[model samples]
Target chain A: MATDDAGESLAEVGEFAVIERLVAGRRQPDAVAVGPGDDAAVLRAADGRTVVSTDMLVQDRHFRLDWSTPHQVGRKSIAQNAADVEAMGARATAFVVAFGAPADTSADLALELADGMWHEAGLLGAGIIGGDLVSAPQWVISVTVLGDLDGREPVRRTGARPGDTVAVCGELGRSAAGYALWHNGIERFDGLLGRHLVPEPPYGQGRVAADAGATAMTDVSDGLLADLGHIADGSGVGIGLRTDALSADRDALAEAAAALDVDPMAWVLGGGEDHALVATFPQAPPNGWTPIGRVLDGPPRVLVDDAAWQGNPGWQSFD
Target chain B: MATDDAGESLAEVGEFAVIERLVAGRRQPDAVAVGPGDDAAVLRAADGRTVVSTDMLVQDRHFRLDWSTPHQVGRKSIAQNAADVEAMGARATAFVVAFGAPADTSADLALELADGMWHEAGLLGAGIIGGDLVSAPQWVISVTVLGDLDGREPVRRTGARPGDTVAVCGELGRSAAGYALWHNGIERFDGLLGRHLVPEPPYGQGRVAADAGATAMTDVSDGLLADLGHIADGSGVGIGLRTDALSADRDALAEAAAALDVDPMAWVLGGGEDHALVATFPQAPPNGWTPIGRVLDGPPRVLVDDAAWQGNPGWQSFD
Candidate 1:
């Protein structure tokens, strides 16, 4: 189980021994009563409710080993899943990861992946309680995040009614722009490309939005327009956006857009994976939140500047 | 979202539309307050605790598309994760699945997989509360199960003492024997080969074992010897198996073993993936459980008939 003797494949080390190395010297959080090395992990949910979500990332589809290190993939996996918990107006307490990779993969790479997961979990004060490791043709990671509601009513998507102000926090269009840069083989936008690899979700902002009495909340994963459509469709209310209000976000991506000869507004409107927190507030949103739209009295639809702006709505997995 | 079109691929149907088809017509259990349609699902956990576990399955590695139906793979995925919950002395309430597969895959196959999961979950009175669908090079399914303990204490591996009787419920060595039959192209044992595709764990036996005062328990995911060795190492006790008590299991695999020209006892003692429940009871195990071994005071090791048995210990992911 020792990493001192290197250059062995995972199959040579065996599953149990590799597991021993993956699990060694890691500290579990207080919420985990029975951590890994058990049949199942026991996590305390004092509020009598557990917010759960899952996301699977396949190699080359969700990430590229050539573009990002195993550590970044690990962080991105946890961060994206954690963003879901945050969108639910809950704080993630623990995660159980299931990883599949080729047998010849280095144990050190797996360790670095775990290290990345631990680092991301630490940022949110959570732990990786349990996991399953398996062999696959390519790297596949599935993360399930368990979140605590802290005795608050889960801010569901159905709660956004007429006249609620739509607000967002954290970066927008950054990940999409970063992807564009990396895809185009541009090297000038170091920060944008890095952001695409490892996103910085506005941690704890979910709790703050919840405490501020936000009615409905979700994270921007499938672009602003597409994700807001979820709230619109779920709440059965139309949302109208002010293009002027999103100028700041458009400006943030302007340089990258110019370099790519693309419309910056398109990135701001249709880019995904920034993991920014977007919510609907019956009153003024909390500090550091930007108001961009308002829930309207109409059919379930999203409008840009009181009109339909026809562009690429957002990302879809099969596309 | 409707799957009215008979021959559309996942890419043609699209991710959101495919997800809608997969989730359609499924009734969630009472424990799910909010199911699907949001960033996360909220499950009721009135016990102030939730038991969690996860497992991942990859195509051509964990399962073969030619050998097993998509439905069988789905059942196997859920059944194994449910077994982990059952091992914790908890009743599985909800499951969240993350699935990845090729874009050109048939959408109906995806529905069949969901149907299989729902059918298996119905066996435990649980629900497939939420799921995510994405594109991958091959099929990768990850399932996270959430369970409620119903106020009973979790039977952990560290609680087995020197004198506790090791008892087991459900079939053993069937999957391994079945794997051998399939590998050798022997089609004589229908039951064994079918079992290799979908394991039937003693559905409610974890709670039964707990009610009968089981001190420690685990599922036989790996070989019984390897999993029991985990208990031995965790509890600081040795496990001594009575081969006489395992004659029934060996006999069950004898026909398959004879066809493969292998030892049936080796399969019974060292096979895994049957997902049978193995527990340590201070007294007699509950009715319907078979006594197979005893705990002893010594270093952590597994002995067969008071002596070391040289054989394959169990299945490991890497190996």
Candidate 2:
């Protein structure tokens, strides 16, 4: 719900009025044939193929309202969903969001969330075509992204083969590092703390990697090793990550790790939510991508320097 | 997450295992070029246009867990989103769901939710392609439906004219009556209580109405008066409803209304979430549709019996 600068609550502004305010003055791309205020929005999938993915963020569970502004939460929601599309070697075309909050939540906060979504979508030249608003006990944001593959075959998780080189094309462990910093209430490392709230995924690298003959792709939503384990399981191949290949990432995080009195390697290898594009290429990867591992012919498993490491593989929702 | 049919909880099953269990044994339609297990699911929109809409259901706000089984909740989520697509004169083809719930929730409850979704999708020949599972303080489900226009122009809400007849193609007031019954702890009338739990929109009627020269269309999501008000405002015209025309819906709920000591007409005219397709047609509505009102050529508003309605208009999220 929204109103003028008088600072009205969502409950006071009403649902329809808030929707009108959110949609007004917003520009939609050519792909959006029909925008908001309709029963459903029609989007032109020029490539005829639509890549769809969904993700949900709960207050305190995924993001804390106290740690992030509504705008950042909105941006993170869109960014993570966009990362999913990017992982499929597709370009995001549009997004539809569903947000829920208590009735007493401010209309300004609601609009701020939309502003954040538009900001993130604008980064990739996409649009927020439609959304739903509802009342709930706590804040919850769920985003669904639609993308166009533009005639390219989707790079799947099961396409990795023996001799494939595993590479990553975005920051590693930064979000986790930031998360740790935030958890410990550290005041230093503003950049790292910011990254934890809003990740910068390698937006177009999935298509670049695909064009370069990458066989398999996925975003590192979970830790790198854990996400690679999915690719390994999907492809029925073993993956070996060389520590030397990841030394740069470790060094990048060394300062943060030292400040926290933790091992940089743990964050570099086991941390997640960076939304980094990780793929397996049969040959050399495209520029800006770093080769960190290789596929091996064996049962599905991921290794660090040809050996299993006794550490947490990645995040487990329940655990 | 999931395991053998041993009645394991979601916490015990884990996110990945629960997803595997939910997606396993499910068949994806041909339009689904690529299904689950990827960062995103690829859907083939041969018509080149995708109709997208989203809706969110919170645990207590939308449906009480004690009042509804997980299966019913799943069906309601899909049904409501699909109804939006149907209102646009499109057939829902694919859906992506993002579900959040307490970690200790039973894995079987999660599967039951999926089963209910599949059952509803099967009715429309659609598929549930991809999803995300995360831990939340309470259950939250957000669904986005991708529909195909099949080359037909979408019937929007801004096209009704003075001479068009207003008609509806599904039950009305049943959900409201059911809700009231449930709220009053009236144990009798299982059908009314069930209607509150799950609405049965007249599926496939949207395209039928579009093909039969419907000038404007929308789902009765927020009561006949309120939803028609949307059309009136969008079309910049007035709408007048005939009480006699909606006598059938009133009659259907009369017994329940009498038992509950409330006016049946209030439920018929103001209740929402029935997902009934209400449209303005240039002529008598096609078979299976019942006329209820007429379009007026004047200031935008909805009037009952040539006068403004004094009862509650409809449901509002914040209100």
Candidate 3:
């Protein structure tokens, strides 16, 4: 990667030339039959089933350019979409991105964004197969991921039943704690601040949970309680969360919470974007999973210690 | 489709309820094993291969709210992405859309947009499997289409050879001509104006061209000459289009061109978004295709009547 002309904008370099630069020297995965520079990319789905999902990140609504670098934005966009496919018990194999940005934005920034996307996709052994770039008032990135189910029945949120053990794999409340730290302009807690910019999802644990006979599962994108409520409602079962079981997550953010004069439990219970996988098992959970709750026979609702949560429920798109 | 509460906005309805309204009562294609309401969608790819493409439409960039309705915008977004899959000689099976709009936007309008997407998807017996809705400063819609190759090798732009006949299926320059008529506020040509808002891509014709032994193919998204230039460059051949052969398309737009005091041939040659399928065949094309050019042995370039045309070449994204 060269930066001889750092000030050159996308409009000055032209769309096709910028695209060529972004795509040059990138190696696609073996699953790609036809990669970039084609009308469409052809991907191999050996299991005869493809799992697909899409997510869009707006400039201010999703992430601010000042807070997250173009590379972090790219990684966050890819990670969130991949988490959706992972929740379905599938392996993400390919991605097609559509990016919109101001014409005066530097072509170098676009390359950085692509680099970040490739960096994250490489972690899963997947490829950034294709994408479209166009001008916009502000930066917008939309990613759609295609995954392989590998002959496994997809884990759905509606499959949970009474007596199932509620377990989770991956970090919780890190993103929320980071967001709060960043918003308050606090310079301390660098890890929490970094987590707010880019989340670390437990990649292979999804298939692990599915193989262990997990009855239901979903990724925590819209807060722990909020996402769990979806599974509870969909399965027509009540969920009871044990605060003692989640003490570790709260303790991890205790310092940040104390500095901001807020309750650490709020972040663990109501924050989102950690992309952790939560599932319900019929019996004791498998390795790398911690039991945090229990599925009970009752009306569809989520109760924290046998009572409703009094803090913010979760993130709302329009609120 | 009842618009009982036209005054309600997305913020009032909430994201989940608004999504429910859009997904309710929609019948998915049989190929979809799991549709909306799940974390992700699962589509059956019987050919063991999936063709994928994506496109993004921005407000006041790709479209205008005052000039086009929400339904028309929805149709245009889906049509453009579907055209990409069609160009690969595949049948589009499912679509996943991610939409961002203002919080104060009407939920009914969102429903109308979904209605328009379903309307277009139904034409191909496809389905709108899943989507994401979020708040933005302006409307932004990004659609990704998944297609099944059905055991057919995808037609690529690099497959053409010297001495092949260049043919086209579907209309040309209509969108560009309509754009001119609308730009000047001359609404007399209602059909042309409507076409400018929502294009009608020649669906299912990509497979026909593939079956007919077409060597190379592309959809006319960036004008006739610009798109043909892609095939020409990729195949390392010269493409000489015959103006006399395109008389029918020119004559059809002559009235609109005359009113705008511009040459109809310019629209036919440089206009884009018509999404007409153009391909090179070793023999005479199948029924419903018209011969328009010839592939010749030379450096890659596109010529009009053995010479270059001095006019607007085509639409450029940055410009």
Candidate 4:
């Protein structure tokens, strides 16, 4: 099915032609003052400040091509980076990606990946402004997201104080439970399996939390407790989570946990990659946000129901 | 020499600890409203527009550890991305890096890489805001830079027209010549070899050209003629280089070409990664810019001494 002009491999089509094809016919958002084809892209920051973050996903380490379509990989890459911006109490406006793949990969696959990125970016009303493509032994996608704070002060992890209510605004444990199902080769939970491939981050919720006066915020990239540990350490306060409050999350994954013979609490407490928005508030949380715990006095640790539960803390890059 | 805690590999130190060591006690610029340790960094844009760009460097393909120290690699990464911002007629203000390395790498080496990045960023009064670290089979560094345009209209590649003089600032052919010398194992031209590892882009000259009424501009990341071909194609015009005007650039690389048995003109016309600023001007060129070519009517092509070149055009990622 290979054509003489299109090439059988990326090496055949070459990097420049592939990049040109990837960039062709794509529409940029209004916020983008200057788009791709230049050394850099210029984006308008209406509020005079920009919130920025970056994430890297390596093949086999982050995802297996056999399990995820290139489109799903692209969406996941964009979603995860966008989540970081959301965690900062800002709205993502633009993204610049740097992708590396083997030379023999099909050009069509790369286009599908770009399409997936565009699909996800469209959801946020953001644009893919610029990117660099290169040859590597495997696929490696690195994304950097720029966001606007809308003149509001940033909600940092170091701002949480004792007695602040800890709340969350998205699903948790589904991705980790999906990982378990995928590892065990149990395909019964289709939704959970899909969640592992592409996460559903609650868009526009960061601004909502900021408007509701969030004292501190973060995304659940690492397990809930592990991510909370960062806030505790950064803010120098203890964080205590209530298991009763997370029963809904645990129940959602009870079936998968049973199939894998693991504690559902482990997934609820220690699993990660759900991209859930977690924030602390001095008063009642805004709509769609459910209170899960409270900030405690000094000691700098994340506790489960007032006690330190012993289990796998969270995912480690080396591990 | 291998102490347990002192020289532990990245895997032993873990991602969090390694990051803590990398970011510990580093000073950030005043523009950085938020730095590392948060889910994202917040930077002041001041001018309501942020210029963004991304570049990926792969080990073996982009740089060899044998030829460059981790510090040089870091400097090269930051410098190249900063050149992209400068080309857009903006001042680089901040950067975010996503670095992937094997788990077996030493933590000291990563800290050294960060040290080099900070050193290069300091040249432009910019700060590294945030970054991501993950495990990979080899080293892959991706850098995204954000710049401030200060209310100036962005100089685009599609703005050049017929009757415009093409001018270039900074040296050309030196990086490619240095690469050739290093590839051929000729050590006579140490400065040329160093230039290959870390390009010296003409800093702040892009804004100067833009202020002086240049029509279009781009950085010479690819070879001069090849990069000019982009300007020609984007601007829908032809570019004719006057070889006699490039005598100074040729003379600078003659000794290196003689040492490596390659044509100095080939390096000047077809070498990439020098990152010199090339632009089109309707009138006399700006101070610091030297006239090298002229834009022609109709067809989009780059001519060397008014004739089609018969050599390698430039670099492609896959090739």
Q: What is the per-residue lDDT of model 1 for residues B1-319, given as tens digits with 9 covering 90 to 100?
A: 1223368999998998999999888989888988998999999999999999999998888888878888899899999999999998999999999999888888998998999999999999999988889888888899999999999999899899999999999989999998888888988889999999999999999999999999999999998998999999989999999999999999888878887889999888888999999999999999999999999999999999999989998878976
Every candidate's CA RMSD: 2.6, 2.3, 2.2, 2.3
lDDT of 1 by residue, A153-221 (tens): 888888898999999999899999999999999998888999999998999999899999999999999
Please give, for residues B33-75, the per-residue lDDT of candidate 3 as tens digits: 9999989999999999999999999998898877888899889
- Cα displacement (Å) at residue A205, model 1: 1.5
For each candidate, report its DockQ versus the true two-chain complex. 0.88, 0.89, 0.89, 0.88
**Interface DockQ of candidate 1:** 0.88
Residue pairs that clash (backbone atoms under 3 angstroms), model 3? none
Fnat for each model: 0.95, 0.93, 0.89, 0.94
Clashing pairs in 4: B223-B271
DockQ value for model 2: 0.89
Give the DockQ-based CAPRI class for model 2. high
lDDT by residue (B1-319, candidate 2, tens digit) is: 2223357789988999999999999988989999988999999999999999999999889998889988899999999999999999999999999999888888999999999999899899999999999998888999999999999999999999998999999999999999999999999989989999999999999999999999999999999899999999999999999999999999999999999999999999999999999999998899999999899989999999999999999999998
Screening candidate 1 with a backbone cut-off below 3 angstroms (N, C-alpha, C), the clashing residue pairs are none
Q: How big an interface RMSD has model 2?
A: 0.7
After superposition, the stretches of candidate 1 with alpha carbons farther than 4 Å from their true spots are: A1-6, B1-6
TM-score of 4: 0.97
Model 3 DockQ reads: 0.89
Which sequence of candidate numbers ranks them by DockQ, best first?
A: 3, 2, 1, 4
For model 3, state the Cα shift of residue B133 in Å: 0.4
Supply candidate 2's per-residue lDDT for B92: 97
- State which docking tier applies to candidate 4: high
